[model samples]
Target: MQRTISFADKPTLHGTNVLLRPVQASDVAASLEPDHEADRLTGTHPTPGGLSVEQRQDWYATRADHADRLDLAVIDQATGLYAGEVVLNELDDDNQSCNFRICLFYSRNRNRGLGTEATRLILAHAFETVGLHRVDLEVYEFNPRARRVYEKVGFVYEGTKRQALRWDGEWIDAHVMSILAEEWAVHRGYPEAPAS
Candidate 1:
């Protein structure tokens, strides 16, 4: 880990399956469209269709300008197409930690290890290259798939925020999970090594 923190470089990190690069306006087709499954998994509450496409475009257009947080577009290597995004935001510089999130745009991208690989790549950049002491994320109990991915990447379960979200008439618990730089040193991303 470096002594200083920096997300200004907007790095292009590569994996065997995907490439993580800075997102641009040209990557903005259907990104603003409503994804019901994505929304449910992330527990995102829709706000009456008031989202501005132009504003979203402007946001994507200027992703490279931010120095405080990392937002990389996940691109499928075989197709050379935009898959989704993985982000590290809410930087707490004093504590050397940040919040993490990832989302894929299409159904074809799910259940195929894209999110897992993307999580591993960004967390690597966070702890190994970006000099963060810790990276954390929250996953609602309804989304076991995401929780499992975080666990596979070595994030320890911190605790649960009870009744944190209300959806489809029932309350859900949000689990807080985190991984420290030291833990990354031991496991990198995979907590358990694959069978030789």
Candidate 2:
């Protein structure tokens, strides 16, 4: 069975200091490098359920073909280099909802406002172009930096899944966060309506 989905080309989203564009085939290898390095450094390598580099490439190819997933590469508009990646996944048509995930591949980009800005752009696209009523995400408690960015984007703490993830033989808690369309409108200071 085939799923109906949509993707926007050069869907330029303006961040505080970056621009977000659709992920291209050329970015697969480079994008995966940082993710792998980060995982190794943080001792959070993927489990059996996670995808390998080849698997991720295949997945990206599939996602690129489907409109249901919006995966974008965050670019630093100043230098025009790949800063990170952001994605709105698991799009549910019946509920008009999706979950989001983001990561800044380069360590140099950390602690800057880049992540927050990139997040805002993706959230705006999800709630605006994608016409999603709700957006949600899960973050490990250890990843305080990402959690902070999510909070800044108006994602409220819904609850926690105790010992939800096992990393390096230790259990970690996962924080469930979500934002409603109304909340997004309030954040953007606009009345609820589709973007033109």
Candidate 3:
């Protein structure tokens, strides 16, 4: 039997530092509030007015029903709190590729390796479980830290879309990166590991 990919069935993935599970409504109230620093780092545009709490809750409440994409809440195991989110969207069944993204709502969650572990967990699911051929993402050039995490997970730089984001009267380049199933088989999402 051919193994199939189904985003409809939500899953819980455990990692050393984090857990990836379907987003809960509580996560919206507790960890999904808009943060300017996260938006800037992820190159997301701030809503002109911002979403009402109800709107956000409704969004998270229905994430489990989406069949075409997977949205997982990043839970910090050490603190047992909702630290952030990791999403796999823009699915291309024909090509077996998807776009990847992640964000941590609070600064305390940043630089703690939670994001890296969360990323690896999801990528393993994408390639090992879902059998996707490729997973891609875009990172603003201004955020080298994020790019480094992507690199550590085996995503290779493909190219850059020049000045893809204009923020604060400045142009920011967006770097496109991707990892292939073949690559994942070799690295298992730890491309930076020193060979023993």
Candidate 4:
């Protein structure tokens, strides 16, 4: 029987340095702050001046109403502040797969293994709790650090989508990567070679 998927049961995933919980309205203010580095790194080109308070307010306020996707807020354990978010969306029930994405609000949250831990927490919930067989992502070539983080969490390089992103008058390739449930059962987010 094919396992069905529902993200309605948002989880509060805990780690040594980060915590993942259902997104709340309070996180909106922090999210409104512009992170140019994050936008560039993630290949996101948002509307001029980013989201206004009212738009963000309505969006976050209704996060729970969607049962098709899981959206969780990442909180830094040390500072107890909303650092970012980890999402699993575009669910394919028959294939038992979904796409994963994560973003931290500010540069201060980068390079500290916070994103890595957050990624592992969400993947665990995806493969273990949600009974998903696969999770995939696309990372732009220019942002290698994010790709490295995904690889560390057991997502293997599948192929590349040439000119996937048009940024700053240049086209950039986006690398496609994925991880399987069986692979997660082995590494549990830490990639390693099977014994020969």
Candidate 5:
């Protein structure tokens, strides 16, 4: 029998540096701060403008009602502040797979290992608790730091989508990566292979 996974049980996942919990409307303020560096690093399209307070609040407020996807707020444990977000979306039940994405909204949250811990916590919940068979992601070629983080967590380099993103009139490649449940069973988060 195929194992079914439920994204509805939004659990608060704790790590050494970060805590991943259900998103709240109160998170609107911290999460809405605009950072050009962050937008560039994530290869996000420039929105016409920043979201209004009401729009952000309403967006976060409805996160709990979505059963098909998991959206968690990344909290910096030391300061207990909203650091960013980690999400598992585009769920394919028949394939027991989903897409993973994470971002630290501000410069303060980067380089502190918060994103790494948050990534591990969510992947653990995805494979061990949710019984997912696969999780995948795409990283822009310009962002090797983010790609390295995904590699350290056992996501294997699958392939590259050439010129998948167009930023400021220049095209950029997007590297595809994925991790299987079998791989996760062995590595959990850190892979055992010797670093090249």
Candidate 6:
């Protein structure tokens, strides 16, 4: 049976030159492409599991209707192309916090400041709409690009787990980062970007 979930109807978020909307059936193809390639480059950081296109589709189908997870498709507004994907996963029952992850499928889309803006939108929604106290993430120390983006949005490095992830044939450290609602409030300087 297909599970149904109720989410904020209009999950539209604007970035510097892109927009993030809830992931849909049509996006499965594009979203799967970059994710497959990214696996080879980074080799699954937090979760040591190998990547597969079918696995990604199944994962998306399962959470696509889940209320607790806000999975989004990153779109380049200028060309109307899919840039990547981002999500707020594992929401707590108290509605006080959740974890986030983002992946840009196309390498050309990187270094264009889209990540910072996209992250800002997600962080804004997490604090304002989700009414969460904290938003946290784990980054492989090797993924400095993502770490930089998170830091730009005020996520401080709280700690690190040495050799927490095994990729290829080696183990690597993972950085733990988090940001409080109070800190996010100050960064956006808004009352709250209401939940849709």
- The global C-alpha lDDT for each of the candidates, from Candidate 1 onward, is 0.88, 0.75, 0.89, 0.90, 0.90, 0.75
Which one wins by TM-score: 1 or 3? Answer: 3
Residue 107, candidate 1: C-alpha displacement in angstroms: 1.7
**Regions of model 2 farther than 4 Å from truth:** 1-10, 32-37, 40-44, 47-62, 189-196
The digit string of per-residue lDDT tens for model 3 on 1-196 reads 2325567778999999898999978887676455888989887787788788888888999998877799999999998889889999988887889899999887899999998899999999998888899999999988999999999999999999999999999999999999999999999988878999
TM-score of each: 0.94, 0.81, 0.95, 0.94, 0.94, 0.80
Q: How do the residues 1-196 of candidate 1 rate in per-residue lDDT, one tens digit apiece?
A: 4426778778899999999999888778847566889988888887886557787888889878878888899999989988899999988887899999999976888889999999999998898788999999999998998989999999999999999999988999999999999999988998978756
Q: Cα lDDT for residue 99, model 1?
A: 98
> Looking at candidate 2, what is the lDDT of residue 107?
78
Candidate 4: clashing pairs of residues: none
Candidate 4 deviation (Cα RMSD): 2.3
Worst 10 residues of 5 by lDDT: 1-10
Q: How many backbone clashes does candidate 3 have?
A: 0
lDDT of 4 by residue, 26-65 (tens): 8898877678889988888977776678878788879898
Candidate 6 Cα errors over 4 Å, as ranges: 1-10, 31-37, 40-42, 45-62, 189-196
Better of 1 and 6 by lDDT: 1
lDDT winner between 1 and 2, please give it.
Answer: 1
Superposed Cα deviation of residue 139, candidate 5 (Å): 0.3
- Indicate which candidate wins on TM-score: 3
Q: List candidate 3 stretches off by more than 4 Å.
A: 1-4, 32-34
Per-residue lDDT of 1-196 in model 2, one digit per residue for the tens? 3433344333768776988887775667766554564573344665676777777767656656766778888888878888778888787877888888877786776778888888888878777776778889988878887777777778889999998877767888898999998898876523333567
Superior by TM-score: candidate 3 or candidate 4: 3
> How accurate locally is residue 21 in candidate 6, as Cα lDDT from 0 to 100?
87
